[model samples]
Target: MLKQNLSPDLTPLRHAHRLATLYSYEILDTQRESVFDDITRMASTICRTPIASITLIDAERQWFKSEIGLGKSQTPISASICAHVVLENDVLVIADTSADRRFGGNPLYTGDPDLKFYAGAPITTADGVTLGTMCVLDTVSRSLTQEQIDMLRMLARQVMMHLELRRMLRLSEKTSDYRARMLASAAHDLRQPLFVASLSVQSLLQEAAPHQLKRLTLANGGLETIKKGFNRMLIAASGHASFTLAELDDTDLGDVLEFIHANFLPLAERKDIRLSVLRTRLHVHSDAVQLETLIGNLVANAVKYTEAGGRVVVGCRRHADHVALHIIDTGIGMASESVNTLFEAFRQGDAQSEGLGLGLWIAKRTAEALGVSVQIHSVPGRGTHFILSLPLKASTEPSSEPIVQVR
Candidate 1:
């Protein structure tokens, strides 16, 4: 009597193509589903086998997508019987493992569950790539009838259809999420500034004096409020327009601090609060425009919350490979619980304060785009400090470095 060879040769190129097709489905390592479980259960019952599995051939293993009567989730590809079925791209049936020299020595045939009979139909894609097998296993030697074999192939096709459906559902979910985020960003950004402008107008109507000149002075404050609100709206719009890394560059930390001082000094003065900058000669890797917006928001927030005669200080602390730009203020600080939610858009620490609570949120988003880290420390009734740690940019020219305090 002559022995028959049943193992199919799996070439490297063919295996690579099969793996690529499997990955495109993105179904590997996903949680168990009743759909797949039902299919495997049906396969076991229809074939009169003790075990059935929908096995996927991964890079280094054969992972069971669904299994009945199997405790393990996966097995090594080297020891996998389905690995051979996938290579054949057709149904493989072994009536008796002990009689087949190819599987008689396989551990699965000799070990627990002691599989002596096996049949598998390859789960093939429409493009003809065989990703894995839908198979039945039995502890005793047996042969499947022609009808049973045909049924197994049909079940394999059903498995492929389910995988395709799952892929389509995942893509649809992602598209919906993207659209929702876009709508939320646009609505929030536009509404924030308009809300602030309305508040400013209301304040002007109530605070204006009888004398023309005094009314003009009162109107100046309201106009400033409108201007600041528009600035915030513009920044938010730009952030959402098309966020990318192309806006990044080597920016001077000192120059940004100076700009903040120039812009916010009058607002600080009108409130009878002290504002100062402790300048440094540090240059950091960041987007200059976005970095300025981030620092400006922090400073403005500090000024808004601080009481008359309180102080807001902007400075830098040097580190070995990075520098931390600190905005410290003597203000009505926040509770520890509130600190966590400070960066959430439209969340205000003090509902009584004027403006939409997007300042810190915008700052946080800008810092992320620049790959910088922002940290906060606050004590109720004492102060709040925002620290932005930035990577130090390399420079060719070395110059005198000094920390100069300016009021």
Candidate 2:
């Protein structure tokens, strides 16, 4: 009879437990054959047995996973001695099966070549669940030396290792598939806003008045925002490609702030907010592109969270051996908790906003790469102040320049 009815009280759980273990491997019918077959072949040759198999015990049969010298594919559990070895959950040795009580009356011993010798070791997982067995059989009543039995068990451990590798490979493929889908979805959602903004700007420029030109300028700002967001996503995807820093140049902080104010003033005006550049002509030696992106991200963040009619002030001060630039804004500033984890990649502490949560992280990393220091102080209800300190050129003396709002 097929051994389908698992006993509720004692040995019955073994059938169900083995079935569960077999399913967990996720390796049935997989075509990428590994070196697991070599173990079975080696085991057969070393033991000098004509038949050997790596059998996975199922609910009603013994599945021949990796077989050597076996013409039959699988065997019914009722006729499989390997199935009995799995049920016992230990190494089973019947030196002379024909002389034993359990095998003397069995058909596999009494009818088929009069089977007389058996040695099987349980293939158990790390958690002590016996999945199946690696066994050798012969028709003559014979005994295997102790060393042969130990080597057979070692080969069983190799089968367990093969199953574990297949499980990890499947998991890694799944994670990579999920990330690809996420990037594809994010690209689709962001394209709509960019297309609308570009279309609006094209229509406005045809018969634009001076005041409407300002409106067009503000609308064009959305295109830049979308582009910056996409660039940040690309940077994340191209993970940690190192950038080579060139020698710093003599760059004026005032010129950089003036350029930003000129570019963003119309956008701020459209929302009834005011933007001011309070200092000009403060010079330093640094990478201009890095400085531009770092400042742009900070200013963009300020504009995004601030309410209409609020003010954003950009200024710089001449410190002893460095120049300090500040961007202060009356915006919906972050809480203490958000500030604590602000520089961590993909970790957005504020749940109410929609973003990739990579701006501040990229900004901080860029600043560190350029040997600049950035600090922030904020309260949830009040506002935020971001301070950037850049080292000064040692040989050049400070130039006297007026503090004015320049276009």
Candidate 3:
């Protein structure tokens, strides 16, 4: 028998955690972003549904981040199909809403849309707490193929990645000791998402077909990027004044490049930029998490500045006992004088560019901590190339104190 309550179990313990996790992202009631709208549009087309929405079920209402055809921005949770899915914590599908006894008396059916179909995949955080769903609805009775269902779920994961990225960036804005503590807390929270995402990719790979399998692989790559970034965030927060290496190990340059590709592919594609990575097996002896953080920041900044039709290529080569990681972008570059200030705190190169301009500064700090050198070459209105050089092996004389040196 179906549960009488349409909403989730309101047990104080679990419910509060779920709501707390949802609110922590600071996404509720925010203006719609094209990134999210793009996800919903893809769902509508892929699922062949007339109406699709990224539904966040808050305490009293379901706020739609990107409501494609619903016309309204939100509705009461009492009339929400997504709230029911929240309780199940999995993909929920109803071929014919009217035929389902669980939603028989729901007022949504009597509304203008007269919804008849729904397939919702949980938008679960790393903590395993479900905040909402990437759901598609149809006015006529219909069903989705297995592939469609998987794609829907995959899209939901992408939504979580964006939310996570935004959360980290928003919180990173505060540079106080208190902010570092908060960043540390946020970084620790990501542990749950990273582990869950890894396990999920493994399970999906075993059953996914060739095409779907490829996407799942890329999704795993995306997971690796987030995992490393947040782990580095923890490192940064823990030693706010001086970056610390959690572990010094053989870091694969190829894997880092692949991760960079997977994580930013969507953003680059959206900007009509060609993002490429050189296939390499070369390794560098450093903190794997720090490599991800610094390199991730460089690639992120490259993609942001590059114009449409421009290209960003990341590659590396061995030089003596060192490896020079190269990230070249055909973006609007800055003057050499402007480049000098790129690593300064709270610096902005382009007034029009969003962000506190702390990306490269963070990269510089991480590189210095790793005892590496960064070379930036750029021409205003031309392009930029950032080269990060580090020893192929760890230093023989390792100091416990933080290393501070000129770039």
Instruction: For residue 160, give model 3's deviation from the true position in Å.
Output: 1.4
Q: List pairs with backbone clashes in candidate 1.
A: none
Residue ranges of candidate 3 with Cα displaced over 4 Å:
1-14, 175-407
Q: Between the candidate structures 2 and 3, which one is better when assessed by TM-score?
A: 3
Q: Across residues 1-407, which tens digit of lDDT does each residue of candidate 2 receive?
A: 22232222224535566568778887554432325456677678878887777887777767777776666667766667776677677788888875666554566677755667888888888778877888887778787887678767867875664465344334423443323223323443464355446645755666699878887877678676776675455334323333356677888777777778887888788877788877666678787866876787788777767789898888877777887778888887788878887775434434444554455655776686567899999888677888899878676467554333222
Candidate 2: misplaced stretches above 4 Å?
1-241, 347-352, 399-407
Worst 10 residues of 1 by lDDT: 176-185
lDDT of 3: 0.75
TM-score of 1: 0.43
- Per-candidate local distance difference test: 0.74, 0.67, 0.75
Task: Write the candidate numbers in order of decreasing lDDT.
Answer: 3, 1, 2
- Output the number of the lDDT-best candidate: 3
Q: Can you list the residue pairs that collide in candidate 2?
A: 7-12
- Residue 407 C-alpha lDDT in model 3: 18
- Worst ten-residue run, lDDT, model 3? 398-407
